[model samples]
Target: MNLKYLIFIIILITGITLAEETKQKAVLVTGASSGIGLKVTEYLIKSGFYVYAGARKEEDLKRLDAMKNTTSVRLDVTVQSDIDAAVKFVQSQNRGLFGIVNNAGVGVFGKMSEVPDKDILWIHDVNVMGPHRVNRAFIPLLKESMGRTTIIGSISGYVTSAESGAYSMSKFAVEAYTESLADDLRETGIHVGIVDPGAYKSKIRAKVTMFNLTGSYDLNQELTEEQKKVLNAAKERNNKLKEPDEVAEAVIHLMTSDKPKLRYMVAPTIGAAEVTMKTTLGRVVQLNADQQFEYTRDELVAFLDELLKENSSEL
Candidate 1:
């Protein structure tokens, strides 16, 4: 080869090598249109990671795509075709996937005995099965990269309320799913975790209420006095809730940390944390109430102390 041509080739090869080395690890965040999902996406991009922000609405997709270091994917977690296309799009980018944040979920509130079966199924489809579908579709990519996957669970998984039976059931199912997934991938060098967020400012309640009353998230339709009261209560609670930045921080840690935890409860207040832990302990007491092989109080306390020490060491 001529001297000048050889030098040009060297420069081209060097450029390609640098590009490969400097490429940012990409993370897929479903339901990135708003709330916790959007917060997680923003945090990842700002932390110098690439984000494939998934949103169902075209306008939301445009907004996400406009953000720095983001490629908005039109992913409807409930839709298999959308998920398939999203997987293909990520593959075409040639940036191997590093993590997935299953954040797309819906809420439902009503007496379990009277709530329509369709409504219950709808909540499950999005809140429970959505993560299942997305994770299954992307597990191959995750395995190739030895990446992490985290589900956006809720404190509701630990404490079920009277009117939130459907929603709580879905979240509880997510807890089980995450644990099972972690076990399945334990030896594959792929980490799995769950982030359970307490009440935070978000449109989930509004969406669920409106959809349940009007068959869609449309407020144009007139609501009954009782329904109006429900909406007002949600608004009041939202006004007092904090932003989900802390939840996003936990997600970032799970993705980047050397020893990521299996469960993270991102409660806004200490009271919230206490309530969840108490509820979990209450369940243990209930299970032991009439059991033949129940542990004594001292034994249970010892077990808890040991687990706490183990967890603190990991941190």
Candidate 2:
């Protein structure tokens, strides 16, 4: 090869390498105080990405701040001032935001009729409006990056478990909003996607219990000992949930992949169940619908009986 051509090729390669090295790409994760959000922040930091870990609590933020190559910012998704402050902080960093993991959410478990209107509203505000608030605040940064935004949603967004009525409703709304946002942002080179995790162990279960206890709403008058037992059993099952790190791994993959998918369902059982519902049951709705109803009823009844018997023995 000619000397001139060799020098030119070397220059081109150097430019590419420099671009890769200095290219500014940042990931901002909400609810990074704990659970999946904290795990995601850790993974991103390990992978050498500039991460802004946003949380409502100052202590959690301080913990993340102690890590190298990570910035911790106070962000309460439910509060607009906090959201605006976080956005301003990111903008000041000048690294250019690339991804957003909207993991801040709360769940309220109860019968729809039994849950107070205030509790329902609060759940929706956090689960649905919280993401919206964060997105609106940070969308400019996402757009500036041009098509690299990932939103962390939940599997509950698609399927509704009867026991967590208010939670399911909020997640359902989130699913709709995510889909719509994906469509809206498609042409603008700003990708909007959702990660629907099935069951990952987190403080969310304890938070759910706390919400139940602290809620001003009264339990259903018709709720028999049997119904209470079933509810408690369900809560126990949730307590033995999957690890948050697994879901965090999924978030990292979504954020880093060149051709990231629009929707990613994390766990095996929940993913399979969602696919089956959409492909099998979804097609023949009414026919298999009754079978699903019978299955759930039978399981709930069995769970209730076992729980009640256990409680009676304890008494």
Candidate 3:
């Protein structure tokens, strides 16, 4: 054989070996019933990785189970027993878990004053503690694989909108906790990262609005008709969000890359928001710290006058 041909054959063999190594890797994705989690699971499976998709509903699990190269396990991140069962299912697969995508969480939108304590606690349970429970349950498996565990957080993790305080608080907690976890696991060869996506077209916004806020309250009596209109406008803005697949693609990129980043802001909107929050406007707002006092000082007259003026300019 020619020497050139022999060298070519050797390079081809090395490439094949690397591809095989990548194919053997497996991943577990939580909250696979719908939205971003479901889409991410589908993308991973299509890329030829063994995927364990977890959902609280068996019907949804069965739907994902029907897909090729995928398995579904019943998992409610809020429950430890369910998490244990999910871990056991992955262990039984015999592929050795390569990644854990903590994608299960919910959103809540309401003023902290209007939202009940019970609702706030529920948000924290599902959004913050849920990921913590799953990470704890699957850390050993992730460590065994010696790869990475990607946490699917949100843009709210870094910035808070007016009505989404509860949800934002939960995501902020997730961000801090995961960052600390990443540092702690750096030496162990098990990487940790966060995917903070902006608004995605998902059931989350509608579901949160429907479930977290209901019934007539005495607080509503105090709220003027104009205040109600402003609240509805905010909800409408959220309804016009982007698709979940955008977020799924980002998750897949983070998972498959050789050198993953510690955090990824999923879309341009999030990137823009982050930039704005770091700019002069954010600094000015923080420095003043008297918007609330100024508004209440004159029955929100100045606030409403400025708001109407902006609306007129837009029109």
Best by lDDT: 1
- The 0-to-1 C-alpha lDDT of every candidate, in the order given, reads 0.91, 0.75, 0.77
- Predicted candidate 2 versus true structure: per-residue lDDT over 1-315, tens digit per residue: 999999999999998976774574788888888778888888888777888888766677789899877889888788899888888888887788888888887778877678789888998888789888888887877887883666667766666655777887887787789889888888777877788777776667655654455442223334457656655765687667766776777777777776666777776475655663574344444453567454464665677689779766643
Q: What are the clash counts of all predictions, listed in order?
A: 0, 1, 1
Clashes of 3: 1
Better of 1 and 3 by TM-score: 1
Tens digit per residue, CA lDDT, model 3, 1-315: 999999999999998987775567788888888778888988888777788888876678789889887888888888889888888877876778888888988776777678778778987898788888888888888888887887788777766767978888888898898899999998889988899887776556545544534433222344456666654665586668766777777777777887777777776475656563564345545655665553243544676578779766643
Q: What are the root-mean-square deviations of the candidates from the true structure over C-alphas?
A: 3.1, 12.8, 12.0
lDDT of 1: 0.91
User: Which regions of candidate 3 deviate over 4 angstroms?
Assistant: 1-23, 212-240, 268-315
Model 1 pairs in collision? none
